[model samples]
Target: MPEALERTVYVVGPRWHHHAAHADYAVAASLACQLSAQVKKLNSPIEYRWLSRALVRRLLTQSKGEPNYSLGTLLTEIVVARHMWRRGGSLYHLLYGERDRTLARSLPRLFTRPVIATFHSPPARLAHKGIDRRRLRGLEAVLVVAASQRRYFEEQGVTRVFVTMHGVDTQFFHPAPAPAAGPPRCIVVGGHLRDFETLGHTIRLIRERVRGLRTVILGAPTRWQQSLYSAGGGSVEFRYGISDHQLLAAYQASSLALLPYQDATASNALLESMACGLPVVTSDVGGVPEYTGSDGAILCPPRDPEVMAQAAVRVLDDPAYARERRVRGRTRSLQFDFSVAARQLLDVYATVLGDAGMASG
Candidate 1:
């Protein structure tokens, strides 16, 4: 194949929302834009074309829905795969694996070109969602956010699985010039796969130990979460749908980030908090250690509120310890910068295409 042809790739995923007015941290989660920017920076021959949202909407209106899958998403995958089968490319990369199983199952009949996907869900969640080998039959590579996820895909016979780092915009989420003046504040962001019972208990415990403690919960929580975490609340504030600047301000203002997770692959909230120079007290489960390592953040066993509370209180009480963690976390976050992730992903593309020299220049 010609080098130009080999460098051409198509990316299919969720509709991207660009926040040009705000910092990168304010932008919603999606790699399509970041990947494009990095490829340009490398000055590589790679050409990426993302499917338009308008096309996706049109397809959704014309297609029937599938059980347990979004009608628009299912139709988009089928249509995109069919289009790629007719029109040749070096590879087809699905940005989200959960949305691509139908495409994977149908790819073998449509074409023989290599197809790769990135899977974000943890093993347990994937298994619960019925993501078996059959649904993932035609994928040439499965890129996961954590090494821990490799076993589940490998056990299901995915021979070419790779761990890809989840990237963060370090420039936008940098530490504050000076700590905010007020009572000690602990910020809890996001509600996905979070152990709210543990969080609630930990908050109660921390409040008793630390004087003038304030807890801020970010993101839109469910009724269950709101009711559970808000009960017997003392200085707990819940903020929903705030702008990116406000979100960044919350992280900068907080003394520490308290993230109690039931399970995780990679957490945006964890990464962003660390990038903002806030020390973390997170659960030691599924890829959390991989991101934080030994010294970057304090880790507690899952569902253990006492340990979680103790870690948070320690950060709040000890200035020297908090500074050490703050510096270490900021340094750790640089390794997972968007540029690094982009380079790694391009290497994955090269491997799948069997072009050893690709992206080397």
Candidate 2:
């Protein structure tokens, strides 16, 4: 067991957009390419399955009301367990908290390898399920993306943990050679608006606070989201379900971006928006403050429509300040670039391998 030899680190999770060129899937694929490690994205196929009905039903029954458990959820757990047992390597799962430790426990008992659980968000559901704090001991190290999530993991008694913030790909998200300069252009992105009042508030601001400003909302609509849009008086242009390139283009075209989530962990949209040379007006929730640093973006207390509106106008009206923020944000966004992220991830794998006495080069 040497420290210099490279060892396999598998990222097991529910299926991301492996078939399509989506950002989340692209992030996973890009990370794998950068690390030069084995990458298998397992998505639970809802329409078809090779598993027996009895097994599927039993799994569904056991995973009821639990986060990360659907037909896809069941398939992911089973497939990941089989993959780990069939061929040996260090197990690294990218998920929020230990909400689904049952999947982690499925690793082969005699393999004698460590499971590194990367916590992406606060365990909102684990607390709801009343899962005991002691169960997290199954993981060897908890890699956290935010301080808030780190505190939650510490409360869960997962002492062997480290904080490694999420990174973005600057090269892909770089600002266009030139940004459009004209009337105020605002871009609002992400989903599930009803769950978060930010959308309604943002629309209200567009209607009242900043009149004559062009606003565009991106992503497909959920039923609840439609209700939120209706509540906003239906004046804003809503572009439902667009490609990743379209979203990036919208960010580049707009004067400012709005990421007003109710309870955010780390928003991919916000990061991508900043990387595209637009200053983000986001809620000071989850890992946002960590990503924006001090100079790049505007942070407001969540759930306040007036404050959100005022902040949006401030960025849109002040050209000098807005340009400065965009430059600073774009610069900071480089830290999360895939190349940098892959190298840091490899370091984590090396640390885990060294601890486990596996060969690493």
Candidate 3:
């Protein structure tokens, strides 16, 4: 295929796990895995592939120990570019996350192959400074995780757009059988404890509004998680470093899932929770509304503790409404089932390669 044994593609991103990073990296890795299978389906060779590093020592030097943009992520992109150039391959696809529009823009011109970028969210403040509208035009396709992001990219002139929803391993997040029980258990998974100040503040509010609620905060503890439990007036419990399956059980056991983010779009926590047949209470930020929809979740304003608290209370008070939302959420999650989304992504890759092959011929 394409006069080469192995076709190469690269993932551009920050660290692969923890907080929001987990979903983006997981999606990219899954895409790569799926692509490997499809390429074999086409009887192509298993060739070179690279993933950018997760740590940046250089950026730390410039910012005096804090990188404005992730140095590890930038280096990773650069490494991938170097690999493509060295391999002399004419086909490359870029799956981007947590970086600048301008930097991503330069990649297609530099790499001499078809580039496709999946926009994880809007550009950060630094990257926003010299953002180039031209960046969106060169890619074979600009993937938006949520329909809500489509307009923003359109404004930037990225017309060849596709809405590929985020995916979760159904095997990992399958719904549990109906429990013969009393008050439905509820929990919030993947709280961004790295940004604990905001996370803790929101949990405190949830504690106030919903009394005697068994809330489990999953992820490594930052000072904020500990402080939230200590100062939370004996309501919320903190559990650190639980395996993914255990996390899934938490979702299966819970009646509702809460995603309290200061600002985020298409969070994995929301999808995983919904996949486990749990309705959600999440902030109305980014592409979240697109995924959660009207039937699946209760939306609240960002960073407003009072509003978030009330949203959680609403779910606790109405069993019928909660059950309806959970049913809808589970149905919605199937639309993003990995098998479905992976095939779509494989189709995109096939399209890009076919076009490249035509131009070369």
- The RMSD of every model to the true structure, in order and in angstroms, is 5.8, 3.9, 6.2
Runs off by more than 4 Å, candidate 2: 1-5, 14-22, 25-33, 37-50, 65-68, 92-100, 108-112, 123-126, 129-135, 192-198, 220-234, 359-361
**TM-score per candidate, in order?**
0.84, 0.83, 0.72
For this target, which candidate reaches the highest TM-score against the unseen true structure?
Answer: 1
Whole-structure CA lDDT of model 3: 0.61
lDDT of 1 by residue, 269-321 (tens): 88888889999999999999999989778999999999998899899999999
Off by over 4 Å in 1: 1-5, 15-68, 225-232, 355-361
- Residue 219 in candidate 3, Cα distance off native in Å: 3.4
Instruction: Give each model's whole-structure lDDT.
Output: 0.74, 0.64, 0.61
> What tens-digit string does per-residue lDDT give for candidate 3 at 72-149?
445555566566567554444445533545346666677665667777664442145433365565666677677766
Tens digit per residue, CA lDDT, model 2, 1-361: 2123366666655424421133342364356544464433433344445778998788799768565556765666666665566766554554533445565544534355567666564557446545446556567677776677766777777776776666665766779777666767777776732224665756666666665677777763654456556645655567875776776677788888877766655567777888888988888766778888776678888777678778788887788888888898898787767665555555666677777776444
Candidate 3: segments with Cα more than 4 A from true spot = 1-15, 19-79, 86-90, 99-107, 123-141, 155-159, 180-185, 191-211, 220-223, 303-307, 353-361
TM-score of 3: 0.72
